[model samples]
Target: MTVGRVGKEILEEADFNKFRQALIEELVRKISRGGCYGADIRQIIEETLREEEFVNFANKLAKIIEKRTNISKESSNEAACQLVEEEIADDIKGILHGQLEERKGKSKKEKEIDFMGRESKLWDETTKRFIGKKHGLKDIALILKEHRLMKITIVTGFILLIISAFLFNSIYKAIVVGLTLTIFSGDSLRIKLANVLGGLGGILIFFTSISILLQYALLEERRSMELKEMARDYLEKAKRKENFN
Candidate 1:
């Protein structure tokens, strides 16, 4: 079988860790054999590149290529074989580099001056934008606006509360009698059953209101925590950028 086919077979298992382990094994073999494993290694990388549609794995593959080539250079070889192996290693490295460059979307720079002063413009935009005293309030407002579920739940709870009030008001006597039937003292079985049902309905409505209020409280807490997390992330990024400068 061709080296590419061999690589395809190795990668057929489709586990990244497995592929990495197998690549390491191949690298060790290549080092021991003074770069005889060059084609097989290159083909393995090619297969990986083909399998991964996105370029997320490009950087990792680049690192692997670096280690593989470094080991190939250190391996012992006869004078004639050393020259041939070195050439093969160089070719492999060059191909890998080219593949990486293509994936990165880099191209030759255009011959143009900074006539628009874009760098200065960007600096001004970044520096001039102030986080005001009310920025925290503004961020909270933004979060509330963005959260549809929280708003919907609160509104639904309010509507249900209103409905419960209307229901209770319409049948107040029934609900009251249902609670204290012994006090009324002239109750038939059918009347008692109706009163009991009316009271249960009122109780269910009140419980539903309580449930909704609890839900709102939980959602509010979650949103507050989320805001803190966002602030922390922003601060971290700013700190890193400051350190980098």
Candidate 2:
């Protein structure tokens, strides 16, 4: 799609609000799940809002709420105006209750630390629950391990591309090879980019790769059409020859 059309669609306020509402509803549903904890809720919110569309909607909604509620932009205590907290108060309470119940068998000190960890900040408290001290490190390791194969593939592909470019002594050929590799490796690129640069950046890379692939597809399509026309001409000539015979 053209930039102008994308801009127009993104700027539509009604659509933006609709997306925001949908996002809010999804968060509520996730939070209300049985055995759901504050950490899970935070994860849900972070992953959902990571999308460019959702992020844009959130920023717009926050500004609108600030204006409507007369909350000063300079005020640091605007968490109360947050869409999730405002719209899903009961659901949040339920989630908190579930979390509390889950911790029933733990020692008082453990429970206190967990509560204090979450109470440090509203959103932070909700997501920063006690999953054990080593949980944080394990989470990081798991994330890296998940993308280990993709990283290896990307490195191997680039090395091969570089070697081929050197052997052929043609930068143009290398570029075409690189684009082809990128087009086919779109999923790996998206996941890596999102993990490294966040959701919006990943999306940008994904679309850029798709655009390049589309160009390649268009070129092939044109070539196919030309070949079909040529075959049609050859068949016509052969038919005329047969009739003449």
The best candidate by lDDT is: 2
Segments of candidate 1 deviating more than 4 angstroms = 1-170, 175-185
**What Cα-based lDDT does every candidate model obtain?**
0.34, 0.40
Clashes of 2: 1
For model 1, what is the alpha-carbon lDDT of residue 187?
58
Model 2 compared with the native: what TM-score? 0.25
Q: Give the TM-score of candidate 1.
A: 0.29
Candidate RMSDs in order = 24.3, 25.1
| Candidate 2 lDDT, 132-221, residue by residue in tens | 122334543443355565445444545555554554455455555454433222355433432323222334334544554564445445
lDDT of 2 at 199: 26
**lDDT of each residue in 1-245, candidate 1, tens digit only:** 11223222222323334344334333333322332211233333334344444134433433333232332222211111212222233333332222111111211221011111122121111111111112335544444466666545545544443443344454455545433432223357544445455545445545544655565556545544443344344445555887999
